[model samples]
Target chain A: MDVNEKYFKNISNRERAIFEGAITMGALFHQFIGTPINIKSAESLEKSIKTAMELQPCINKVEIEINRDILKKIENEYEYISLTGEMLDVKVESNFSDKSAVIRLKYISELKYPLMYVEDVD
Target chain B: MDVNEKYFKNISNRERAIFEGAITMGALFHQFIGTPINIKSAESLEKSIKTAMELQPCINKVEIEINRDILKKIENEYEYISLTGEMLDVKVESNFSDKSAVIRLKYISELKYPLMYVEDVD
Candidate 1:
């Protein structure tokens, strides 16, 4: 059977925000908190995120952005990163005219610290 | 655990279109076949669609519109409706500026026939 025919079964659209956020966070968690974060780790995280977010209905494309160098630095300093302790700020926005929905997560109050933007194409 | 934390674990966003289309189709199938088509059928289809779609990430709202009378008319004459026989035309459009994605399915060739539009808000 086709993939579409198998999934997207019965969830509500509003809940997608949380879904996307969690996906992005999972990617970030995978990229960081590892044995020395690197560019490859970043790429892997973004790839995972890209693959995950695009699975939603009405989402034709997904674009992600993150600063790997900064992320690596933060990861090295901390023994572990906790995503569940309100550690990250998440935002979900849809630009109708642009035909895209952006899911972003920010860590650290500093300017241009760590941000992940997942854009969905319809 | 949260819904987002639980679901949206794994799935490519691009596949989401197919995922969404199938969900919409399922709803349509339920509303049209083996019964006297009515507004409730359309409502059920749209509602199912909305609930299913909103479950995706970055989707804030879902708006659905369908022609019930037209669908009911088509149902009265046909013994069985074949959806897999290249029967329906599906259109998925994203208006980024408007922050929405519109999924429309048309069954008839006329100017106005059985059409289902499921709009997603992010």
Candidate 2:
């Protein structure tokens, strides 16, 4: 398995205290779960957000910004969800976008220091 | 559940790609798993290292440094394994020591950037 798969599997089991505590943190840590950003069209974007909310009810807010390149590439194929987190900001890139996508997630707890950014960089 | 427990549980599953990838990273990411540093006496320290080897056969090298305060506190009960990682150094403190214990682990892979320091800071 690749690093990405391993990372996801590590957090797959909620039985672990860390995973459970992350959930208990609620919207502060549980705010993410939006639709795949590579898709074009307002309907696809809406569907992604809707699907995200269905999986995670704690997500009260979601803000997505699609660039013109991504808006154009929706007609083709996307390779990966490129993600990068530096300092505190998250930047994402993919074959589907001319410009990178940025998402910011903030929390109230101190545990936030360890997991500051998560990008879908493919 | 506390954040500590949740974090551990999330990574408990080997099925996740990230967890398995960490394993595949081998000594680069698998250098840790030594005897708990809080243990006192050369015998206990030896035992901890021994137990660590048994759990992770891939560990080819391990260096340990015990200070005077930790050596002295071995006679009493301690509370936690305080650990801090900043920049590149790792500092560990516990009820067992007057001075903090420090350990550094390095690797060859790029993923090393993500997991900088992991102190037993219980």
Candidate 3:
């Protein structure tokens, strides 16, 4: 619960699902995380993303664009301090573009990281 | 690109490394995704996240919090129309909690979902 990536390395199998969530929306994730996945359904996209999210020790907020007209925020599940007992209706694409523009931001440094690390967030 | 969940299923090898990024922060992606991953380095966590994000056909803005005081927005790499041609300094924790709060919101329905599906926006 220290909030760092090492927690994942302790358990991840480095599979293809890495390309199926918010991580998929980032520039850093695309550069060097895992191999490319290849699923193409709304169900898989949402499920894979959900699978990745549940790993967090804490839940905060989940935001999504419903039809792109409404940006809905699901804060209760996190507020309740528990993962939803049901399935989510979100998903991701398992492909990448050579010319896709994305952003990679350094959000936090594990309060417990042994060494200090700073990213060149351009 | 027609976005959907099944897309990830077509290629996910049921790996870990998933608990290393934004997907690790979602409520739905938590309920059901690939198995768990295991890494323990800030480098791996950041790398895993970046690896997953670059698959989208388009890149958007990436937001990060520098020590939680400075919320930085990196939207250029995404705007320049390409993934950041370098490594990022973000990381994720590969763990979960039974008593943690999280949120899951349905965002899109892929301009091309075969059937009609609407989520309970509560």
Chain A TM-score of prediction number 1: 0.38
**Local distance difference test, candidate 1:** 0.41
Q: Give the count of colliding residue pairs in each prediction.
A: 38, 31, 70
How well is each residue in A78-111 modelled by candidate 2, as lDDT tens digits? 4322111111122121121122222243321344
For residues B10-78, could you state the per-residue lDDT of candidate 3 as single tens digits?
322222123222343332122222322222232343444444443322212222111211112333443
Candidate 1 fraction of reference contacts recovered: 0.00
Give the per-residue lDDT digits (tens) of candidate 1, residues B1-122: 33223332343443344233333333333333333334445566556656764553344445555554445456544433322212334444433222444455555444334434343334
How far residue A122's Cα lies from its native spot in candidate 3, in Å, is: 35
User: What's the CA error at residue A21 for candidate 3, in Å?
Assistant: 4.2
Q: What local lDDT score does residue A100 receive in model 3, on the 0 to 100 scale?
A: 17
Candidate 2, superposed: residue stretches over 4 Å from native: A1-54, A60-122, B1-54, B60-122
TM-score (0 to 1) of chain B for each candidate: 0.36, 0.25, 0.21
The candidates, ranked best first by DockQ, are 3, 1, 2
TM-scores of all models?
0.26, 0.21, 0.20
Q: What would the per-residue lDDT of candidate 2 be over residues B23-64, giving only the tens digit for each residue? A: 322332223222224433445554454345334322223343
Candidate 1 per-residue C-alpha lDDT over A21-106 given as tens digits, one digit per residue, 9 for 90 to 100: 33334333333333333444556655655676555344444555556444545554544332221233444343322244445555
Indicate the TM-score of model 1.
0.26
Tens-place lDDT per residue, model 3, A19-110, is: 22334333222222232222223334444444553342221222221121111333444322212212112223231222111121222223
How do the candidates rank by lDDT, highest first?
Answer: 1, 2, 3
